[model samples]
Target: MTTADLHTLTGAYALHALPEDERREFERHLGDCEACTQEVRELSATAARLGLAVAETPPRELRERVLREITTVRQEPPAHGRRGRTVTTGRTGRWSGYALAACIAAAAAFGGVAVWQNQVAQDARQEANQATRQNEQLAQVLSAPDAKTTSGELTGGARGTVVVSQDRNQAVFLASGMERPPSGKVYQLWFNDEGTMRSAGLMNPAASDDAVLLDGPVDRATGMGITVEPAGGSAEPTSDPVALMDFPTA
Candidate 1:
């Protein structure tokens, strides 16, 4: 093969689409060509990224169609040059129709990777923004002039404190020394207003230094309590509370 033909086979080499003999010849050429080596490395990394991006299984029909095309596709005879050796015309001719199909597939795969990367970045940004807003709201409630702070102990050697802001209708609960809940179970928070009890939020029992900023109707709450419940939490306290702290009223 000519130097130009070997250079053109870089993509095929990267994709493992080159014929055995041509692949060996290309490897020899790659040793002396820094540009081809770099190109092959870049193409390989792109292929890896594309593979990671494609998480879903391809449709059954796609495999069936490709197999059908392989059976029907015809191969033309290779052209002879002055030295009686075969000379491929272009990228399409250098490899078979399957190689052209692969090129198209690679283009589509890269496009998918771009879209997947954008979606991941967008999700991360949204999560960061949400965390920022939550922190700000928590800070506002904790720093409020009318906020009330109280502390107490629980049943399982756990200790908890709550700071409530009647002005902002929010509260912050901090707890420690709670053991991790059993599998399929979770700790759930509750707000009791007069005799009515309502779910405040779920808790992570594994947290040694847990801090949760509770929202919704905090101004009317008479007390806060936590209980063990199912994994997703429950509408009401399923069991006796591990901890309970009454809000001071004057």
Candidate 2:
């Protein structure tokens, strides 16, 4: 490839889309070309971040569509031909093939980046929406006219609290210094109805110190309790309560 062509391949090189032979040539050129090397580095870092931006899996239809196109897309022809075929001289024919391929690869790299950019933006918006919903739920319980707060000490000197709003039929659980459960286990919240226990929800492992809105209505439960249970939580508590707090009397 020509010097100009090699320069144009920086994006393609960063994306690893160049064929084997051209990729080796580009690597050797990178050692002497400072500009190309810097461009490659920036593009590579952007690519890595985009890869991690989305957690949802791609749809199967997208994969199948791409596979179908691969079969029908016509590949570029070779730059030179057999002795019997006409061969144009100079850049018009010999170098045109390589240049065309390099340009296409560069375009593909930019297109891929664009698609990732859109996906990342969508993921960010979705997370923001979820956070907003959670905040609203917490606010409802905290601001209710009948809201009552109860505190208790958890195992290992941790602290736990519940903000119950009977009028709204909602409650929020808060914890501080709550350590992660051991492997194969999780922390679960429960509604204590007299002597019977009903599962409230599994405590979030990601944020041990954050407030969590209880999963179900406070209903007739007189108090809340926490227990260590197997991962995914149990239908019923199988262990002793680590923490319990009874709601204040009316």
Candidate 3:
């Protein structure tokens, strides 16, 4: 594989989803590349945390279907007697037993694959539902009768806007020409209440321009601010804000 292709395998490698040959190749690459190694480590940790999510029980109908299918599978009688001597009927009987075992192994493998696919489908559905809900909330704020919008300038000539609705108690932040943040740091939003600042959330570092719905209610917040903070963010601002948008007086 090309170097770029190998780099993209960090996630799959972290999840142990790579084929044996590809996994070995990636592991050898990992020994020399620091960035891929770090990424794989982080992805593995994130995967571990996500694994803690509660798994849903299979549907009753699915269980019943499996049970019914089980009844149709032929059972193999013991090949050995109580005296521990082989009790083979003939050469055909031994071959039949081998074929049955192979069928059973294949069925078991397919069953595992089915379960994994179902889990992946469930995770996708949950993520889609979450994104839908967020979009609905953003629409409410943007379409509110009392919503007001304001714009401001960020450092390095970038610009952003804040659209807030007192009735909805929500706000949406939109930015343009945003540069990538310095390594190990993130662009964080804050709810500027009077003189105090509360963390709204972190912006997508990779997005040059994006709309973000602020994380909390706009209650009594006179303005919004964006600051560069360490990754994962801080409880309080550690540096001057790159941009600040003051809400109009009510």
Total clashes, candidate 1?
Answer: 0
TM-score to native of every candidate shown: 0.55, 0.52, 0.57
| Residues 71-165, model 3: lDDT tens digits | 23322322122133322221122223465567557868778656644664554344334444665576667667897888878788888778788
> What RMSD does model 2 have?
19.4
Model 2 poorest 10 in a row by lDDT:
86-95
The C-alpha local distance difference test score for the whole of candidate 1 amounts to 0.61
Model 2 whole-model lDDT (C-alpha atoms):
0.62
User: Is candidate 1 or 2 superior in lDDT?
Assistant: 2
TM-score winner among the candidates? 3
Ten-residue stretch with the least lDDT total in model 3: 86-95
Tens-digit lDDT track of model 2 for 120-158: 455434433444455556666776778788787888887
